[model samples]
Target: MIDPRTPVLVGVAQFVDRDSLSADALSPLDLLAAVSGAALADSGGRGVVVDTLAVVRLFADSSPAFRSPFGSYANLPKSLAARLGQAPRRTIYGPVGGNTPQLLVNLLAESIRSGASDVALIAGGEALRTQARAQKMGLALDWSEDPGGEPETLGPETRLVSAHEVAHGIAMPTAVYPLFESALAAHYGDDPLAHRRRIGALMAGFTRVAAANSYAALPVERTADELITPTDDNRYIAYPYTKYLCSNMFVDQAAALLLMSTAAADAAGVPVSARVYLHGSADVHDMILVSQRLDYHSSPAIRAGAAQALAQAGIGVAELDHIDLYSCFPVAVEIAADMIGLAHDDPRGLTLTGGLPYFGGPGNAYSLHAIAEMAARCHAAPGSKGLVFANGGYLTKHSFGVYSTDHPANPARIDPTLLQAALDAAESPPFVESPAGAGTVEAITIPHERGIHGPATVIVRLDSGHRALAVIDTEAAALIDTQVVGRRVNLTPGHPINHARFE
Candidate 1:
C-alpha cells in the first residue's frame, strides 16, 4: 500500500483576462481568489482544510515604484486568504522568481509527505495588462486593502544580477538573455540568418499550441518565416531576438494548484481519477553571475536537476508522455532541451499551454500555468507521465517535476543543496570590472528601442583571460551584423562604462 502521507495534486485551474478594457477586470488578488475557488471546485468540492496558503511573489511586488496603479496590499497572502474565506494556520509569501511556483510545490509536497501539513494551496496571478490599460486610459481603480498580519516569507531576498553586470547595463532580462543567445548561436555555428530560422521554428511550434489553448493571452499563430522575418510589428528588441520572440509579460493571467496528502484526498471524497501524483521533483541553481559562468550556451544546474528528478521517479525522459520546458526565450528552450535529452521535434511537443512567449509570461507565475496544464493533461490521459521545467532569473535557478496519474512506489525525494554545492564547486572564470588594452569579443548584443538602433553591449575576454563588458555606439554596432565572437577589439575603461572598438 502507498504511504498515506504521499502528496498528490488534487486539482488545478488557470484564468486569463484579455478584455482589459472592461471595467470589471479582475485585480491580481481577485484573479487569485477566482482561480483558488475554481481549483477547489475542480477537486470536486470547496473546503479541504488547507493548513498552508502559499503565494508566489508578483513582479510588481519587487519594487515599490512598480506598485499597481489600482492600489497595494500590505499582506498579500493574508489578503488573498480573506478573499477566499480561508484562514489557513500558516500563510507563506514566497520570494520573487519564476521558479517559485514549482519550488514551493516541491517544498510543500515534502511537508505533506513528512506529515507536517495535510493540505496546502499554491497560487499566483498577474494583472500587468489590466494595470497598463488603466494607466493608458487614466482610469482609477481602488484595489487597496490592508489585511493586517505578517506572514512567513519563503526564500531569501537577494539581487538577481551582480554589480558588474549592472554597471555594464546588463541588468534586465532583455539585456542579459541576449548575451546567452549570442553565445548559444556561436556555439551551434549558426550564422545570423540560420540562427534566426532555427529559433523561429522552435517558437512557432509554441505559438501553434497557444493558438489551440483557449486561455492563452495571445492565441494567434504565425509561420516560422513570419516569426523570423522582422516586420514593422515584429521589430528587433535585441540582436537575434524579435519582439515576438520575447516572453509576453503584459498579460492578465492567474493559476492555482490544490495539493493534499493521498489520505486527505480520499477523506475529501476526491475521485482517484482526479489525482495527479508528483513522482519526482528537484531544484537547483547555476552560477549567479553570467560573466562567471563556465559555459554560456548550457546550464549545469538544469542538467543535474533534471537528472535528479527523473532518478527519483525511477524513469527517464523517454518515459514522459508530455513535457513543458520553460520557454521565456528560444535559448531557454534550446538549453533545456539539450540538458533534458529531449529533441526539438519530439512528437510529444515541448509545451502544454503554449509557452511563456505565446501564452503570456504572467510575471514569476508563468510555470504555475504550465503545472496546471500538465495536471489536467495527466488527468485526461490516465497513467501517462508529464514533465514540467520551471526557470527563474537568467537560467540561474531551476526546478523540475515529473507527474503522473499513477502513484510512485517510492516517495518523492529531493536534495537541491547537493546539486547546488556541486555547481558551486565548479570552477568559474574570473570577471574583470575594468580592463585596458586589447581583448576578444566573446559575445555581443545590439538592442533596439522603438524600432531604432540602440547601444551595443559586448562581453570581451581580456588578454589575461578574464571577462569584461564594454558598450559600443550605434556606428560600431552596425558593423557587427555577422558573428562577433573571436573578433579582436580594443577596450578603454571609462568612469561610468567601458568602451570597445572593433579592430
Candidate 2:
C-alpha cells in the first residue's frame, strides 16, 4: 500500500493570452488568480483544502528590465490568494530562478510526506508581452496592490550575475549562454557554419513540437535553415544564436498546480485516475558563477541531479517513458541530455510544453508549465513514468522530478545536503579577475545589440592554470565569422574590464 503521507499532484491548469494587447492585457496577477482558481476547481470543487499557497516570482519582480511600472504588491502570495477567497495558513513567495517551479514541487512533496501540509496551491504567470506593449505605446497600466500580511520567501535570493561578468559584457542569458555553445561547438569539432546548422536542425524539432501546442507563443513551425540563417525577422541576438534559438520571455502566459497528500486527495474525492505521484525529486546547483566553473560545455549539477532523482525513483533515464529537458537555449538541452544519458533524438521526445523557446519562457515559472504537462501525460499513460528537468541561472541550478499515476512505494533518495556538499567539493581551478599574458580561449561570444555585432566576450584559461574573463573591444567581424575556441589570445589587464586579442 502507498503511504498515506505520500504527496500526489491532483490538478493542473495552463493559460496563454494571445489576444490582449496594451491596456486590455491582463496583468500577471490576474492570470495567476484565474489559473489558481481553475486548478483548485480541477481538484473537484471544494474537495481539496489548501493549507499552503506559493506564488512563483514574477518577471517584473525578478529582473530590473521587467520591473513593473504600475507600482508593486506588498504581499504577492496573499494578493493572489485573496482573489480566490483563500487564507492559507502558509503563503510563500518564490525566489528568482527557472528551477523554482520544480524546486517548489520537491519541497512541497517533502512537506506533504511529513504531514505539514494537507494540500497546496502553487501558481504563477508572466505578462511581459503586455508590459512591453504598454511601454512601447506609452499606455497606462496599474498593477500595484496591497493584499495585507507578510508572506514567507522561498529559496535563495542569490545574485544571478557577478560584477566581473558584467564588466566583461556577459550581462544577460543571451550573452552568457553562447559561452557554453561556443565551447560545445568546438568540442563537437564542427566549424562555425556546420555547428550553426547542427544546432539549428536540433531546435527545428522543438519548433515542430511547438506547432502542435496550443499554448505555444511562436506556434509556427520553422525549418532548420530558417532558424539559423539571419534575416530581417530572424536576426542574430548573440554570437552563434539567432532570435529563434533563444527563450521567448516576452509572453503572456500562466500555469497552476495543486498538490495534496494521498489521504487528503482521497478525502477530497479526487479520482484515482487524476492523481499523479511524485516518485522522485532532487535539486542541485553548480558553482554559482560561470567564471568559477571548470568548463563551459558540460554541467556536473545536471548529471548529479538527474542521477539522484532517478535513483530515488528506482529507475534509470532509459526507464522513463516521457521526458522534458529544459530548453532555454540549444546548448542547455544538449548538455542536459548528455548528462542524463538520453539521446538527443530520443523516440519519446525531449519536451512536453514544447520548450522555453517555443512554448513560452515565463521567467522563473516556465518549469511549472512543464510539471503541469508532465502530470497530464502521466494521467494519460497511467503507469507510464514521466520526468521533468528544470534549469535556472545560466544552467547553474537544476531540479528534477519523476512522476507516475500508480501508487508508488518509497524508492530511494539521498540527503540533499549530502549530495550538495559533494557537488560543492568538486575540484575547480582558481578564478582570476585580472590577467596579463597568453591565454587559451575556452569560449567566445560576440553579442549583437540593435542588429549589430559587438566587441566579443571571451572566457580564457591562462597559463597559470586559472580562468579569466576578458573582452575584445574591436574586430567584431573576424570573431563572428570564425571558430575561436582553443585559439591563443593575448590579454592586457585594464581598469573595469580586461582586454583580449588574437595572438
Candidate 3:
C-alpha cells in the first residue's frame, strides 16, 4: 500500500505575457497571484490550508545584469502571501540558482512525507522584459513592496566566478558556456565546422518544440543554419555559441506549483487524473568555482544525482518515457545527456517546454515550469514516467526528479550525503593564480565585438599540471577557423591578470 503521507502535486499553472507595453501589464506580485490562483483552482482545493509558501529568487535581485532600478521587496514571500490572502505558517524565499525550484520541491515533498507540513505552495515569476522595456522607454515602474517580516531562506547563494576568471574576461554565462562547448567538441574529436553543425541540429530540435509552445519566448522554429550561422540577427555571443544558443531571459513569465499529501489530496477531492506523484528525487552540487571543476565536458554532479534519483524510483534511464534536461546552452544539455545516459537525439525527446533558450528562462524558476509541464504530460498518459534534470551555476549544481501517474510502493527521497560526499572528496587539479612558461590549452572562448572577433580567453594546463587562466590578442582568423585546443602557449604573469601568447 502507498504511504498516506506521500506527497503528490495536485495543481500547476504557467503564465506568459508577450506584450509588456500593454496598459494592464502585471507586476511581479500580480504575476505570482495570477499563477497562484490558477494553481489553486486547478487543484480543486476547497478551504484547504497551506502551511508553507516558497518563492524562488527573482532574476533582477540575482544578477546585476538583471538589476532593476526600482526599489526591492523586503520580503518577497510575504508580499506574495499577502497578495494571495495566504497566511502560511512558514514563508520562504529561495536562494539564487536555476536548480532552486526542483530542489525546493524535492525537500518540501520530504517534509510532507514526514508530516512536518500539510499543504505547500511554490511560486516564482520574472518581469525582466517588462522592466527593461520600461527602463529603455523612460517609463516609470515600481516592483518594490514592504510586507513587514523576514522569511526563512532556503538554498545557497555563492559567487560563481572567481576573481581570477573575471580578470581574464570570463564572467557571465555567455562567456563561460563556450568553454564547455569547445572542450566537448575536442572530447568528441570533432572538427569546428562539424561540431557547430552537430550542436546546431541538436538545438534545432528544441526550437521545433518551442514553436508549438504558446509560453515559449522565442517560439519561431529555426533550422541548423538559422541557429548557428552568424547573421545580423543571429550574431555570435561567443565562439561555438550564437545568440540563439543562449537562454532567453528577456521574457515576462511566471509559474506556480501546489503540493500536498495523498491523504490531503483525497480529502480535497483532487481527482486522480490531476494528481502526479513524486517517484524519485535527488539534489547535489559540484565544486562551486568554474576553475575548480574536474573537467569542462561533463558534470559529476549530474551523474551522481541522476543515479540516486533513478535508483530511488526503481527505474533506469532507459525506462524514462518523458524527459527535460536543462538547456541553458548546448554544452549544458550535452553534458547532462552524456552523464545521465540519455542520448542527445533521443526519439523520446529531451525537453517538455522547449528548454531555457526557447522557453522563457524566468530566473531560478524555469525548472518549475518544466515540472508543471511534466505533471500535465503524466496526467495525460497515466503510468507513464518522466524525468526532469535541472542545473544551476556553471553545471556545478544539479537536481533531478522522477515522476509518474502510478503510485510508488516506497518513498523515494534519500539522504544525498553518501554519494555527495564521494563527489566532494573527488580530486580537482591544482590551480595557479598567475603563471609563466609553456602550457597546453584545455579550452578557449573568443568574445565578439559588434559581431566582430575580440580577444581570446584561454584555459591552460601548465607544464606542472596546474590550471591557469589567461588572455591573448590576435587576428580573428588565427583562432577562429582552426581548433586551438591542445595548442602550446607561453604564459606571462602580469598585473590584473595573466597574459598568454601562442607558441
Candidate 4:
C-alpha cells in the first residue's frame, strides 16, 4: 500500500465572474469562500479534515491606503473560513507574487507529507473588475468584513525591486519586462519588425486557446497580424508589447485547490478517479534586481527549478502531456520555453489555460487557475503528467511542479533551499545605482500611455562595465522607435534621476 502520508491533490475549482458589473457580482472574499466550498464539494464533501487554509495575497490588500470601491475584508483567510463554516486551526496569508499559488501548494504538500497536517485548502480570488466598474459608475459596493485577528503570513514582505530601480522608473512590470524583450530579440538577431511578428504569432496561438476556454476573460480569437499590428483599439502599451500582448488583470476570477494525505482521502471515500499526485516541485529566485542580472535573455532560476522538478519526479520533459508556462508577457513564455527545452510549437501546448493575457491574470492568483486546470486534466487522463511553471516579479522568482494520477513508487521529496542556494551562488553583474560619462546602450524600452509616447528608459553598460539605468528626454525619445541598442550615449546623473543622450 502507498504511504498514508503521501500528499495528493483531491479537488480543484475555478470561478470567473465576467458579469461582475451586475448586482450579483461576488466580492473577493465571497469568491474565495464560494470556490473553497465548491472544491470541498468536489472532493467527496469532507469537511472534518480542513485544519489549514492558505490564501494568496491580493494586490489591493498590499496597500493600507487602497480602499476598495467595494469595501474589502480585513482578514481574508479567516473571513473566508467563517463564511464556509470551516474552523481551520491555522490560517495563512501568502506573499505577493505570481508564483505564490504554486509555491503554497509545494509548501502545503510538505506539511501533509510530514504528517503535520492531514488536509489543507489553498485558494485565491480577485474582484478588481467589479471594483473598477462600480467606481466608474459612481457606485459603492459594501464587501466589508472584519473577522478579527491576523493570520500567520507565509512569505516575506520585502520589496522586490531596489530604490535605485525605482528612481530610474524601472519599477513597474510593464517598463521592466520590455527591457528583457528587447534583449531577447537582439539575442535572436531579429530586427524590430521581424521580432514583432514573431512574438505576435506566439501570442496569437494563446488567444486561440483562450477562445476555446469557457472561463477566458477575453475569449475572442485573434490572428498574429491582428495582435502584432497595432490599431486604435489594441494600442502599444510599451514598444514590442501591444495591449493584446499584456496580461489582462481587469478580471474577477477565483480558484481553489484541496490537498489531503492519501490516508485522509481514503477515509473521506474520495473516488480513485478524483485523486492527482504531486510528483515533484521546486522554487527558486534569480537576482532580486533586474539590473544586476548576469544576462537579460534568459532565466537561470527557471532552468534550475525546472530541471530539479523533473529530476525529482524521475521524468523528463518528453513525458509531459500538458504544460502551462506563466504568460504575463510574450518574453516570459519565450524565455521559459527556451529554459525548459520546449519548442514554440511543442506537441503539448505552452498554456493549459490560454495564458494570463487571455485567460486573465487575476493578480497573483493566476497560477491557481493553471493548477486547477492541470488537476482536471490529470483526472481525465490518468497517469499522464502535466507541468505548471509560475514566475514572480520580473522573472526573478520561479516555481515548477509536475503532477500525475499515478503515484510514485518512491517517496516524494522536495529540497526548497537547493535551487535558492544555487541562484545565490551564481555571479551577478555589477550594477551602478548612478553613473556618469559615456556608456553603451544594452537595451531600452519606450512606453506609451493611451497611444501617446513617454520617456525612454535604457539599461546601459558604463565605461567600467557596470549596468545602470537612464531616462532620455523627448528629443532622444524620438530616436527610440528605431534600433538603439549598441548606440553610444552620454549619461548625466542627477538627484533621483539620470538623463541620457545619443552620441
Candidate 5:
C-alpha cells in the first residue's frame, strides 16, 4: 500500500503564446494562477488551494522598460500566494539553474513523505519576448514592483571553475557545451562535416516533437542539415556549434506542478485516477569546472544517475515508451543516449518537449515543462512510463525522475551521496600541457582583457591520429590568436611559433 504521507505530483500545467503580443502576454502571476488552478482542476476539480508556495526564480527580460523592481526573486511567491488566497505555511525562492524545478519537486516529495507539509505549488514564468516587443512599441506594461531582500540562494555551494579556467574563457554555456561536443567528435574520429551532420540529425527529432506541442514557443520543424550547417544567418557561436544547435531562451513561457500527499488528496475529495507516481529518482554531480574533467566526451554522473533512477523504478530502456534526455545540445543527448543504452537513432525518439532548443529554455524551469508533459503523456497512455532528466551548471549537476501510471512502492528514496562518492572516485585524464611534434586542428578564442574576456576553450588534437587534450596557459596573447579551429597546425616542442598548448 502506498504511504498516506507519500508525496505525489497530482497535477501539471504549462502556458505559452505564439508571440508575446503584449507586455503581459503571459504574466508571471497569471501563468502561476492558471497552472495552479489547472493542476487543482486536474486533481478532480478540488476547490482546495495550495498551502505551501515554492516559487522558482524568473529571469527578467532585458529589452523591456519593465524594471522588475522586486527583482525576479522577490515578487513570485507573494504574488502566487495572493492569487491562491491562502497564506503558505512556508515559502521559498530557489537559486538559478535549469535543474531547479525537479530539485524543488524532489524536496516537496520528501516533505510530503515526511509529513512536513501538504498541498504545495511549484511554479515559474518568464515574459522575455513580450517585454521586448513592448519596448519596441513604447508601451508601458504593468508588472509587479515590490522590493525585498534576495531569496536564499540554492545551487552548487562550491566554485566549479578555478581562476585559470575563467581567465582562459572556459566559462558560459555556449563556450562549455562545444568543448564537450568537440571531445565527442574526436572520440569517434568523425570529420568536422560528418560530426555536425550527426548532431543536426539528433536535434531534428526534437524539433519535430516540438512542432506538435501547442505550447512550444518556436515550433517549426528543421532538418538535420538546416540545424547543423553554418551560414551567415546562423553564425558559429563557438567552434563546431551553430546557433540553431544551442538552447533558445528568448521566449516567454512558464510551467507549474501541483503536489499533494495521498492523504491530503483524498481528504480534499480529489481522485487518484490521473495521478502518476514519482517512482524513483537520482541526483548526482560531476566535476564543477570543465578544466578539472578527465574526459569531456562523457559524464560519469549522468551515467550513474540514470542507472540509479532506472534501477529504483525497476525498469530499463527497452520497456520505456518516452524519454526526455535534457537536450541542451546534441552532445548532451549523444552522451545520455550512450549512458542509458539507447542509440542516437532509437525509434522511440529522444524528446517530448521538443528539446530545449526548439521549445524555449525558460531559465532553470524549462525541465519542469518536460515533467509536466511527461505526466500528461502517462495519464493519456495508461501504463506507459516516462523519464525526465535535468542538468545544471555546465553539465555539472544532474537529476533524473522516473514516472509511471502505476502506483509506486511505498517509501521510495534515492541516496544521491553514493552517486556523488562514485563521481568523486572516478578520475579524468590529465590535460596535455605540451605535446610532442604532432599535426593539430584547433579553434582558439582570444578573449578581451576587460571583464572576463579571453578565447573560450580550444581543442588541439595530437597528429598521432587520436584525440588529445592540448592544454595551454591562455594569458599569453600568442596562444589566443591562433585560428586553430577548422585548420591544421604543426605542434613542435619548444619551437612553437603561433600557439602554446598545455595546462
Candidate 6:
C-alpha cells in the first residue's frame, strides 16, 4: 500500500540543443511556462496550482543584472512566480551546486510530509550556446541578471574554495578530477597506459549513448583509441583524462519538475501516466579538501547514501530498471559502480542521458536532466523503478534517490541531514605523496608556464622501485625532447622535484 506520507512526483520536463529560440522556441520564461504546463498536464490535466516554487539556476540567464540578495540566481524564484501566474506560498533561490535539483526535490518532499505546502515546482535551464550564438549573430536579447535590492545574507555553513586554489593549477575540473584518477591508479597498481585505456573504454560507452540521445550536446560516438589516444585533436587535459573524457558544460538545455502531495494529486485527478513516487533519498558529503581525504579510491558518501536510499526504497540494484550514475569523469562512474555493486556492463546502462560529458554538464544542474530521464523511464516501464545519483562541488558531496511507479511502503521521509552528519564523522586518512624509490613510470601530468602538458605513458621500474606519476618541466617543448617515459627515474625532492631518466 502507498504510505499516506509518500510524496508523488507528478510531472517532469526537459529541453535541449537550439541554435536559436524560434517563435516556438520557449524563451527562458516561456520554457518555464511550457514545462510547468507539461507537468500539470501530465498530472491528468490537474487544476492544481503550485504553492511553492524552487528555481534552480537558468544557466544562460546569468546576467550581471540578475544579482540579488539570494545571490546571482535569485531572480529565478520571482521570475517563476510571474510566469506561473500565481503567488508562491514560498520561493527558494537555491544555493549553487550540481545537486540542487535533487536536493530541492528532497526539501519539497519533506515540506509536503510536514503539511508546509501542498504543491511545489523545481526548475533549471542553461543556454550558454544559444546566448553566444545570438550575440555573434548580432541579435538583441534582454536577459536580466540584476535582481534588484540588497542581497539576502548567505548562511554561515556554506564555504567556497579559496582563490589560491584557482590561482594555483588545481581549480579547473580536469585538473581536479585527476587527483582522484592518479590516486585510484596508484591504489589499483595499474600502469598509466592500462588505466587510460580502461577509462577510454568506459567513456566511449557514454559517447555511444549520446549519439543515440537526441538531447546530447556532443552527440558523436568516440572510439576507445579516439578517446584515450594522445593526439592533437584529443590532447590530455589531465594526466589520466583526455578532452573527450571530460564533462561538456558548453551547451544549451534546461529541465523542470512538478511535485505535489498525494492528496493534492488526487484532488487534481492527475493520471497514472504523470505519477512517479519517491521511494527513498539519501544525501551526504565527504570532507571538503581533496588533499585531506582519508582514502582516495572510494567515496564514502556514495556508498553510505546510496545504500540508505536503496534500502529505504526496499529494492536492490538488480531490480532497478534504470540507473543514472553521475559521469563527470570515469572515476565518478567507477566509484559509483563500485559502491552500488552494479556491473560496468549492466544491460540497463549507467546513464539515462548519455551522461554529463555528452549530455552536457550545466554547471551544478546536469543531474536534473538525469532525474527527468529517470522519471520518463518509470513512465515507460510501468511497475519498474529508477535511480538517480547527483554529485556537487568536486565530488565533495553526493545525493541518491530511488523512485517507482508502485506506492511507497514507508511513507516517512528520513532527514538527509542525518546522513550528512554520519559522513562528517566517518574517518578518512590523509593522502601522502610517496618519496621516490625504484618503481615503474606511469601516465603523468606536468604543469607548465603556458598550459598543462602531457604525452603520458606506462614505464617499468628497476631496482625494487615504486611506480609514481611524473612530469617534465619545460617551456612548451616538443613531447619527444621531454624526459623519458620508459627510462628509470630518480624522484629526489628539490626544486620542483626531479624525474631524471637513468641509463
lDDT of each: 0.86, 0.88, 0.88, 0.86, 0.72, 0.68
Stretches > 4 Å off in candidate 1: 473-480
Tell me the RMSD of model 4 versus the true structure. 1.6
Please, what are the lDDT tens digits per residue for candidate 5 over residues 1-503?
A: 77788777788888886653854465666777787666667777466757678877766532234345333434567667777776676777765667778788887888888778888888876766666676678776676645443333454345666555554456667777776776677677776567777888888888899999998988989998888765776656665667788888767788888888888888888677767788878878887767566566788888898888888888887988888888777788898888778999889888889988898887668888999999988988977888888887778878888888788863477778877987898765454444555555443433333223344445555556443333344452443223335455445333221244442
So what's the TM-score on candidate 4?
0.97
lDDT of 2 at 125: 83
lDDT digits (tens) for residues 1-503 of candidate 6: 45444578888877776454442333455556666666656667446788888776554333343222222333666766776776776777666667778878887888898888888887776655655555566666555544443222123334434433333344455667766666576666666677777788778888888889887888898888898776676666665566778787767677778888888887888776788988888777888865445555688888888888888888888888899998888888887888888877787899889988787886567887888888888888888998898887767778787888888887576767777887788764422233355544433334322235642322223344333333334332344223334445555433333343433
Residues 1-503 of candidate 2 have per-residue lDDT tens digits of: 77788898999999998885746678888999989988988777354567999999997888888788877888899888888888789999998889999999888888888778988988988988888888888988888999678889864598877988898987799999999999998988988899998888888999998999988887988899998988888888997998989999999999999999888888888888788988888999999888888788889989999999988888888889989999999999999998999888888999988888889998899998998889888888889998999999989999999999977666334579988999899887788888989989999898898669878899999988988989976588877759799999889988889998888
Worst 10 residues of 6 by lDDT: 65-74
Comparison by TM-score, 1 against 5, better one: 1
Q: How far in Å is the alpha carbon of 135 misplaced in model 1?
A: 0.6
Per-residue error for 76 in candidate 6, Å, reads 1.8
Task: Please count the clashing residue pairs in each candidate, in the order shown.
Answer: 0, 1, 0, 0, 16, 16
Q: What are the TM-scores, per candidate, against the unseen true structure?
A: 0.97, 0.98, 0.98, 0.97, 0.85, 0.82
Task: Specify the poorest-scoring 10-residue window by lDDT in model 2.
Answer: 406-415
- For model 6 the local lDDT of residue 336 reads 85
Residue 46's lDDT within candidate 2 is: 54
| lDDT (10s digit) by residue, model 3, range 332-368 | 8999999999888999999999988888788889999
Error of 1 at 377 (Å): 1.5
